[model samples]
Structures are given as structure tokens and as C-alpha cells.
Target: MRDVAREAGVALRTVSRVVNGESNVNAEMAGRVHSTIARLGYRPDERARQLRRGSSQTIGAALRGTGGMWEHTAEHTARAAGFMTLAASTEDDPALYAQVIESLCQRRVDGLMVEPIGAATPYLVAEVEAGLPVVAVDRPLEDVPADSVVSDNAGGIRAAVEHLLARGHREIAYIGDSERIYTGRLRAEAFRSCLQEAGLAVEDASVTTGEAGPEMVADALDRMRRCSAPPTALVTGNNVISWQVLRQLGPAIGELAVFCFDSLENAELLAHPVSTVNQDLEGLGRTAVDLLLARLAEPERERQHIILPVSLSIRASSEVPPPPRARRRRAHKAQAPSS
Candidate 1:
């Protein structure tokens, strides 16, 4: 504190006032103190301060991946609620996720917002029971009783399938992430259900889920196309797979009507504007923060799950069916007449 006073050329008391966020300090003095603190790389001992204040007033967010609109909104919302935000990426690794959560628990964050990865997180239940409010985002953590804010994965898939089927497509296929993940599983299952409801056969070759690599997408495409009656349309489970499938198949994309389960930034820029089910990702982020803050205020409140609806952005992609080779071949056979 004395060093900060000396660096800012202010009295020790003035520096203390600024560090403690006392608004009485003049703006000029506060600015100088903050600038000096920045130049000197100064960070207050939050643990010591929390001990004196009886609460840390900080929240930690453990996410599968980081740096999206959702993370930005959550951090901003927490700040607006007078809580410091701490975030860490779990990289979708179970052990790493547990480690990060444990570290945050040790810091005594007021609460946690997690984008759970694995199917189970039994270890976190104890933390919740111990009064650490937790809210899950994007997907629910199986077997864990926590408030969650997620987009409607099944409904989104249903919208995509119904749109394609209404467009006169009998054969529709899907390519997505591995079903080990919650979102992927819901989407794949919903798509299969939609096909069955329409009295259409659920061809195993039509549903492919694995790593979103070029080879994986290419192989799936090849398998779907090799069937006796290839799919006339395709629905990609997510934006990542959507682009990979589009790029891998290239001109063949025109041959198959496409509907992506998630929207992409440059979707409209393509030669053919791609249709998509736009998830309310930003809403997901804001609602997550809202739920976490609510849980922090009332830790004993019943857990809540908010599922945001997804909408379809109809574009040229799924509106017009391309000329499949099989159709052209059948046309040629018809033209040949008597054999």
C-alpha cells in the first residue's frame, strides 16, 4: 500500500481508499493510482481481503472451451452484479475439468457456472451440497442436480428434418459429433425419431457421428452416397461439422440439400446461402449468468433448467434440391426405353 502511494505520489490513506474502491477519492487521484498499479503489476491479496470481508464476491466459470459470446456475456453480467469473474478452459477433458473446478473451490468463489463435458460429475454433487451454487450451461451434467440453461437440441433437429421432408426429400441424412457428448446424442436421436415418425427407414449409413475431421466427414459422405438409394438431403449437427461436410464434399454439396443444425458467421457468403437452425447462444450465456446470480442469492432454491428455443434460418441451401447422379442415371435409363 505504501509502495502504491509512493508510485502514485499520493498519501497512504488515499491509496488505500482507491484500492478498496471507495468512491470518495477524487477521479484524478483514482486515475493516477490505477495507472501506477497497472504499471507496477499490482494485485491485491484477495484471500486476505475476503477474510476481512466475510465473502470473496467472486464467481468462477469452468467451461469446455472458452472465448465465445457466451463467456463474454457471463463475465459482463457477473461484473454488473458486483462480483469478480474468474474463468478457465477445461478443453473437454474430464480430469482437467475436475482439477479446474477443485481449484476454483479452493479459492472459495461465491459460485460456479460450468459447461459440463463428461457424462457424469458425481464429484461435484458434494460441492453443491456444501453451499457452492453451480449452474450448468449448454448441456446438463448427467446425474448432477444443478440449474442449467441450454438450447433445445431435439427441437432444433426436428425443425431441420421437417423442413427437408416438407421440401419433398424422402432420403435425409445427418452427420454430427460423437454421441458421447450430450448435444450430439440428442440431435442424432431426434433426427432418427423424425425419420421414423415419417415412416421412413432409419438407415444406419445415413447417420454418422464421430470426430469432426476431414477424413471422417469424407468417409461418412461416401458411405451415405454408396447406399442403394442415397440421401437427397443432409443435415449437419453443428456449425463445425457443417463447414467440414460442405468443404469435404465441394460441388457435391449442390447435389444434396443441406440444413445445418447451428448457424455460422459466413453462412450467407457462400455461393448458395446455407440454411441453419440458429441456437440462441447469446441468450444461453445471459440466462446462465442470471441463473447463477439467482442461485448465489438463494442457495437452497430448487434447481431450474431453462431450455432456449432454436429457430430455422431458411436460405437457398435446403430450398432447392440439386440433381443427384442417381436421378440423372434414372432419367437416362428412362430415355433409353426398350432394352
Candidate 2:
């Protein structure tokens, strides 16, 4: 900054104003300062700027688990954008989520990017109403209207169902997350719609919805396997559920074709790579940051909901052979004519 000021023949205050995008620096002066900054390759100290501004150059990102792949990716992406991040997991608990939000607020974070687990709390609504920039990640609140960055869950599920159908699967099982979450509900609706459109009976007995933990997924897979006529293909709602299903049905995995809503960490390295609908976590993080910063820049701007598209990754686990009925039967010769 000092180098930039010296080069631009401006005082330190003038440089600060230009860098912070503050008015009062005339267009000519601002352009000169910007040119000097570019020539000198001068980078402002974000920490010093935050201290001067009396607000942390930090953004709070609330997620489900600290160690989860998605959370790690989001954190890395946020930090890369010149903002520190305060991360916490709600563990799917409303009270915990509220507590984390309050704690982050006390720290005076500039904005929040949350992967909401439970329904929107009163405090969350109040904070947003009071002009705090809040952008929901992955899942949006049911009752609250706020900016959201999420994937096209319905479209992804529809594509997965279509893939299974194309592979000659009629009895397809769906293991979904609890309907309390927006992603889960949308994916479920899509799965049902695709089945109906294909003129295939959606067997209620084969559709299971609840928490998508490993244990829950294992139980769901077990129940599906025990059905009188087991489904030939399975579609899991999320990555965690997919992992559990794979773990439970390890060696016998080839019997049932599988596709999941989200990709697993080691998906590419797996012995039998599982097909998945991949969500762009880094893109989602960057988009949420963009929205929050935009809101901070212009508070009266109309709220926006951004839905990123998901892509299907076809792999070995989803490539099940056609059923016996679909194969041509061997012709039998009639020996009775000779007799």
C-alpha cells in the first residue's frame, strides 16, 4: 500500500479509500491508484483492513461435520477468497445449530453460509431480517426466504432413475434422506415422477426415507434385500448412505446396481467405482460467497436463488447385466416327430 501510494503520488488515506472502493477519490485519482497498485503488485493486508474496519474479515460457514469432505472443500474455498472462516457442525440438531449461529454472531462475522440441518430457527430469521447477509448452502430453510446456493436435486435424481431404466431395471429401490431436508424431498419427488412417467409402478415397499447415516443405510439395504422380489437397482440419496450400502453389501454388491445423489471421497479409487450424481461443492461455496458479498455491497438487491446443475458419473457398480428374462432363450428341438 505504501509503495502504491508513493507511486500514485497520493497519501495513505487516499490509497485506503481507493482500495476499499470508497467514494470521494475522484475517478482519475482512483484509476491512477489502481494502475499503481497493478504496476507494484501491491496486495493489501486483509487482517489490517479488517481491524481498521472494526469487522472481522471473516465469514461463518456452518456445516454438518468438520471432518467431512464437503466441509473441508468449502472451508478451503472460502479461505481462498480472502476471508477467514468460522466452521461448526450442527449434527442435524436444531438447538446446536442455533447455538453455533449465535456464537458466530457474537464474533461479528460479516456473513454466514450455512448447510442447514434442521428447520430455520427464530434467531436465524431475525438475523437475516436485521440485514445480516445469510446464504444457505446445499439446503434452504422451509419458512425463511433467503439467498440459497444448491444443486438441482430433482434433476439429478431424475437422471439417475432414467439411467437405471435404460439399463433394463424395472424394480428400482430408492433410499432417500429424511423429508425434513429440502434436498431429500426434491430428490424423492423426482424419483417418483420419473417412475410414473415411465409407466413403472413405484413400489412403496421399496422406498425408504429417514436419516442417511451408515447404520440407517445398512438397515434400509437389509430390508430391501429381504423383500419377496428384491429390487435389481438401488439409488441412494447421499454419499454417506451410499458408503453404508456398499459396506453392508460388499462382496454381494454386484447383485444390485447402485447410483447415489452425491459422490464419495474415494469414488475413483474404489475396486468397483460407484456411479453418482456429483455436486459442485467448490462452485457452490464460491457462489454463496459471491451472493453474500453482493448483498453486503448492495443490501436492497433482490434476493436470488442459484441452483447449480449436477452431473452423473457412470461407473462399474451401476453397470449391472440384464436380467435373465431379457436374454434370448435357447430354442428346443422336438424329438417326438422322429418317434
**Judged by TM-score, which candidate is best?**
1
Instruction: Find the 10 residues in a row with the least total lDDT in model 1.
Output: 328-337
Could you tell me every candidate's TM-score relative to the true structure? 0.84, 0.79
Each model's lDDT comes to 0.87, 0.82
List candidate 2 segments past 4 Å from native: 1-54, 67-81, 326-339
Q: Supply the TM-score for candidate 2.
A: 0.79
Q: Candidate 2, clashing residue pairs?
A: none
Residues 184-270 of candidate 2 have per-residue lDDT tens digits of 888888898998899988777678888778777777777775665567899999877788888888887777788988988788788
lDDT of 2 at 38: 87
